[model samples]
Target: AQLNISGNVTIHRGSETLEDSKLVTELHNTEDNAYDIIVTENDDESSSSDEKEEDAKQIEPNRIEEAFQVKYQGTTLETFCSRLKLFHDEWYQQIKPYAPYLTIIQSSGSGKTRLVGELRTKGIYILYICERHECSSGYPASTPYVQKILETIRDYKFGALLSIAIKEIKNKNWSAEEFWNIQIKDDHKAECNDFWRSVFKSLLQQKKPSSDSRDENFVKKLFHKASIVCCIDEAHELLAKATKAKDDETYFVKWRRQIRDISWVGFFNILLSTSGKIGNFLPPVTQDTRSARSHDFVIFPAYLDVNTMDVLAPLAENVGKEYDYTRVVYLGIPLWGSLAQAGVSLINLVHLASQKIRNFSKKNNDHLANLACMACSLSLEVSPRIAEVDSLIASHMATALGVSLDRTSILCTYPSDPILASGALKGIIDVGWENCLDTLLELFSRGVVEAGERGELVNRILFSKAYADAVRECFPDSPVTYLQKVPLKLFLKSLLREEIDGLDELLNRMGIDEAEIGFNHWTSLLATNQKYVESGGMKFLTANLVIEAYHRHTAFKMPLGFPVIDHIIPFKYNAGYGIISIKTRIQKKTTFGAKDISSLIHPLNSFGKWKKGYKILGIYIDLGLDRENAVESKAELKSRNAPQTRSKNKNNEDKKDVKNDYDQIIYIQGVGSFKCCGKEISERLSKILFTRPWPLDTQWSEFDEKTDLKREDVIKTFLPLVFEQKQSLVDKWQLI
Candidate 1:
């Protein structure tokens, strides 16, 4: 075995090298060919797979790009491109010939920015000045308008061509500022000037490049051919702020001038987009001088057509089962086929319907629940506004079914309680009574309440179909067929009660004391009216009770006739004689002044104009005591006294007169005279005399001399009675 192993080992080191090298060569060849074997296997697999793929391609063409295509309202970008091309052709022919500047008046949310972005993406040169960007957080507010323009140009790649042209004109290294400021001499730098002029001239020409090459010369030529449209988005804000800037050449004005300079070559264009009327922000120069040479175009979203309906059908259906194709299409058309708007409207409708469903579920009545479900279903089919819903209901469901369903009642029924309807009606009435009927009609039409011809709700109470039905069921014998048959006046009475409670609440809120005066009066009036109503009175209680109560609570008497000494003496004498004559007349007519005899004979005729017989009697009783003095004075006057005695008597009488003049005398209208000092008389008389007239006469002076009377208090007491008498006298005289 040792001999065999030694022979197999081949032990000679130098001689074994040849065999080892051979083995190494063979191993290296195998390792090197291993990669080729793997490659061959892979190549065969790839070839077979490629053939299979080719076969598959023949069967079904590759549509990877088509699979990723997004359509807007079932329209492809190609379709839009074609439409745009047509529009551009027509615009160039009809409008661009006369005006290079176009003002686009677009409705809110009409895709103006999107249009500009799409045009820019399609290789149209655009200088986009978005007013919204100025307010955005990322925008650099302090950057100059000129810098912004340069940055936007650079960003849009148009600045590359402009920079090349500037470099050619300068013919040397120059900064952007320096390039902008460079002036070309007519003779010395004629070629540089011509190149610069041609650069702008080409831009203004707005011609499409003949070649699609991107070489330096071709880029320059393309820029020259292409129109550079300056898009001013939210142009209203831009122009407004621009004009308001304090600089001599406002940023807006300067920008306008720059645009004008470019556009003068007839290739450049200005596209101003505003969401408001174009006339509002249009510069005075544009209006008066027509220097801008602008054409106006009002851009609106495309109206919904059949194609739009088809595109939106899936989305609308996804919203809910309630949104049928017809409903979606109907709403879509008015909203201009805006998917976002349609989505929002559908969301709001669903939310409202859900809320209404929840509310109606709480009604605890099958009829109301059914009504709620129906209304919710109908709401999804109709526009959001109640008026639109009403029109639809009237045209379709109401007329077809011959169901006299009140739209307002249906709308109001969506609320969990009838109180909401009542409150709504109250609110409408509170705004103005004149609008009550119209408001009720509107509410009825909106399905907030049902109404009769006179605008009464179906249920006497708003949104109370259950209560109304219950009443009808319970009171089958009653003449009332419907709750609407209940009188409006009864509703008014209920409203009055609410008003009373509201007034009470308001008064309570005002802390009682602060509102005492008005609250007291109102409470008393309301109590009286409420009592009248509760007593089964049909009509409103006349304001007679209120008037009577007012008068009774504020009862006062004003002193009537002036206290003239001349009138007082004769009035006293007339009272005496009138009393005597009245007694005689009454005694002669009958023993007692009974009504039968009193009517036959005017017992007080002898005392003419003295209807106050007691006053005359009191004055006469006082005058009877003075008759003896009168008789003694008569006897003394007939005695024929001496001249000196008579003179002395006259002097004594003059002294007495002076004393009487200083004495405070109060002449009560129905009472005998009382004489005292001024202060004493004032104190005594103030208690009886309620009013002190302005510009006090002797009687008022007799009272006001001592008391501190307010002018209002005096006027309140006297003015009413005085005016009342004046009115009465006028009426009496008129009657006469």
Candidate 2:
């Protein structure tokens, strides 16, 4: 009777292992076969145990011990085995009948390969392939770069046996000199090479009657009998081809389709697994015309849900327990940009800001910090600075309500005290408190702000894995003193000491006080200007307030124009006095003043054009406009601003007698820009996306060529640049 072993087996038939000696010769030799056998030693097995164990005491070799179990964190065996078993059982059941193409969405260090290996050990033949040169700590063999997987399959069976034999010979502890001394014949070497190929080809083409068969070949034959599961790792990278892959189409996609419809094999089990990504990759499923068989699709996400961040907490904890827990200090500044330019923006802003703080603290110089403080103050004064305030209030409300707070005045305001300015910081920017509240609430509905019960505000950039940690790492000792102590009052004070006093105070001292006096009344009062405060201050104040109001009101809930430029004045508004704007439209077809619309299109006048006597209303590209008399030539614009001139000739009648009329023209006089009927194209696109109002999905690539706005690069580069410039300007002028 043949006795079956319960535990691991050990090979102990001691035949002196030789140079390039096959493992099969060491084991029991089969009829007309000379193949190798690979074995692992167990703790209880001896090196030579062929004789009766009762008569001879078996001694295990010290060099060989039981195979070690793969452990988590280098010590503890993970308890995830039960969960893995359950998941695998469920998966096997669901995918057994149909040809299932699965995408397993998992993050790094999820033991994906090990689980697959264990499944293979359980008799499920999985043809595993991974990306070439894609190295991760958990997996040893990265993906094999073999062009053809069929070659790998053939070699896996026969080549593994050869490797085992070669390794055994190499382990003899003989030095190179002694090994070379032993003569091996050329015929013997040629025989070894031929044996390798013959065994591989025979096993791969298992239908052929075998003259001699090995144990490895038997396993391959068994595997080929049924549908094999091909498990691919890093499937995302495979699918994403920058140009073309093996063909004009993406290799991974094309290969997947080919594998799915392999006519030679009838519905072999196909499984594709990947970590769920929020990107476009998977191609639409094609219909099967031949047989009634079709590929079934399944997707598994890495993350559980947006609301719960703790679903993967256990896995994270397991890995982090050994390694240091990720320490992060999130700086939640409001910003967004293109994907390509994101890192640049974060580097420029985060690193530069951090270094500025460090340098200031080290040098005991408060000038730079004070400058930043002033800018922050000005922004606070001009804008509501709703992000921090609302999030703070929302957090407080959640505490009071004993639930997660939502973004509403009820959560973001003092519930007991109705007026917000009473407790929190206050400044009006022509935008009413009610409207500000609505804006904040709208941002919440859009999922920009989350109601964290804890002090943690959603740092969209930081919380996002792409930049947050990397950025934090980039700035090690970013002293928080500047931002931490940055109260609005202190910021305003810094503006006075550093910026406003040096310039405007000198102006006031020089009796350019008319301009200086007007500036003070219009902007925030610098401390130096308070001494020379005059009665006519209110006139300058009214003008500035009106202009600011025009811009705020016009742009509110309205669309802007293409190549959007909000020009203040044809000339720069530097004289410190406020500006005014005006617009005029000619009467319908009756013809009007010189038909001179030339002054409107000049780059200088393209922005702030003010006319005293004409009707002011908005105009659109109306089809009703009289095209017969309409003049749209360069010569017409050239003569438009010129003073009254007679018609040059009677032949110029068609040009000179071209009658003109305007429907309506909207203008914000000195404010220099008009607001139209829709949201900004960029903003509209964002709303359609992030909010998902429209059925069409938004992509950064969509606007790459369509708009002049390097939406991607501009957001990344300009936002932070504009912030710096405006901040510096505000500081120098003390406009907080």
Candidate 3:
């Protein structure tokens, strides 16, 4: 009878004893195959019974000793094994039928390689390949990859399908010597060598040998069996490099396409494991056209919350009594939730806390170190809240420091409040509210607190990772202080100090004894001045208000010419004074003459000489009658200090003939320069000129019913006249 063992089997033919190596080798050499040898029991019943009793006595002690020893430590590995088995079973079912390719996209450190290794151990024939170097350069060329694939197929002994394929290749035109004796060359033409050529040519020429059932079955199995799996780890690099190469006919591209084609025939399956960059490397046809046959599996690592709790549970149980229970609970549970919510990665938090702990242990300050680790972990949780209030706190600190709020140094100070630290970060503190600000300043001045490279405060005594625990150690029962409210006056002053120009001067001016000016009056003055500034006033001045008031007092009837106002004049109601200079033409002599002699001969012509008086009267009327009145007033004033009769006779004769026939006609022009700081005065004069409706020389009416003009329109009309006057003066000076 023949006995068959399916799994691991151990045969015990005799007692446990050391075997001689030479005798064992000699026994294996005597038989064709050592595994086929069989052993027979002794025929003597008494001898067999004695041997069985001895074996039983020896085995019982060994079995009991082994049972007392520790077999397993924890269930972590067992849990992983069960999950991996389930994943494998599910994945195998999905890829079993006609699926030609399977791609696994996962992040780094997700145990992709380990999972594939486990599958290989379960009797799946996996041909593993990794991109170790640039395939286009150096020793390990593309030829080696092709050779590895062939060698894997040949070495796989789980099935006879590959063996049949090789036999079919020999039966074709490929000679036996060439089939078995071919070698891979290290060159670009390595794929064109006899070995690879025969493999591809044989695959292409596959056909049924006969119509019989056995041969047809063999052919079907050779093409459809999924016995081999090719695993390409980090396949993104390999495929990406091939796509980026200069030549369109590179060996890698050809080999990859060929393998894909072979996969479609259902010869084997391809499992590509990459770090999610495989999509950039795959061809368009492979991605879209063959989507039905290709499958993708994305695997994320286990959740952080579950893994963290599982890891800490054992440590907490073991050290629960030795450490402070509150601190232990903080480190193992609450700290993780806080840090995670604060946007710190779990991996980074673990590394940073561990490093801090290690450093403190090295200095023989384990207790302080533990507290520091706790502080560091908690500090990250509170950083975002600190950042939110940083500007407001800095503004307050700047006020306290008597510095400009915008100073980078003042804005860089770290400000802490108990409300923020406790409510936002769940932090613990030990400090007195009294003199807390003073203590903080003192620490900063003494170099205990530090600043980061960007000038932001780094080591805050209340919440900083490096110093919070130290503060707690020094004053264990100290009360935490909430930030005090700043005074309303000071707060408003801080906010408006930078934006308001000449604020102190304005405040001082307003503080003077101005009880005569009511609050409403001052508000109206300020509001009107603000409008002037917004209307494109070049400069704001105290004189602006006074000028606006003067225009309003005069009923806005100012003349077309610029008005010169003295700056020294007080803003009092009756202090208004002005000076005006006028120039006029004067003739020294007068004469009478006739142009036609015929008027002397004729009777009507003889009276034409008297017509000159009517002409002079017309000239007198053209120069307004006010001119004669102004001349008479000047004569009367001069007569008071001189001979009245003589002055009167001189004025009467001069007024008789305003137009002189013999005297030369002279014109007098008055030019004046005025510098004014107020836009309201200028705009008032511009409005008077702009209201002269149609003609340029039309008189302006004070009672015109037109609406008020915009300030822009006033500026546009006034600027050109001023520019023209300036240009004419410059030209006159140049001529002079």
TM-scores of the candidates are 0.26, 0.26, 0.23
Which sections of candidate 2 miss by over 4 Å? 1-70, 73-97, 100-102, 108-111, 114-127, 133-140, 143-145, 150-230, 237-736
Weakest 10 consecutive residues, lDDT, candidate 2? 55-64
Q: Candidate 1 vs candidate 2: which has greater lDDT?
A: 1
Off by over 4 Å in 3: 1-99, 134-227, 243-256, 263-278, 281-736
The digit string of per-residue lDDT tens for model 3 on 1-736 reads 3343322122222322222111122232223322432333322222222221122112222332222121222333345445444444444355543223444433222234434433433333343444433222211123333533433333331123233333444344333223221221233344334444554454446453322212423423543432334455555444432334464333333334333323212124333332323232232333422432254432222211111221223333344212121122212222322333334333333332233222312222232222222222222111212221122221111001112222112212211111122211111222111122233233223333331110011111211221222333334554221111222122213212122233334223323111110000010111124455577642212334334322211101111111211011112112231111111112212221221111221212211123222110000001111122322211000001111232235446533323222111111111011111023322332222123223222122223446433344344455665434435645867876
Comparison by TM-score, 1 against 3, better one: 1
lDDT of each: 0.27, 0.26, 0.27
Clashes of each: 15, 15, 0
Model 1 over residues 628-669: C-alpha lDDT tens digits? 222111000011111232223644653321221111111111
- Per-residue error at 145 for model 1, in Å? 7.9
Error of 3 at 413 (Å): 34
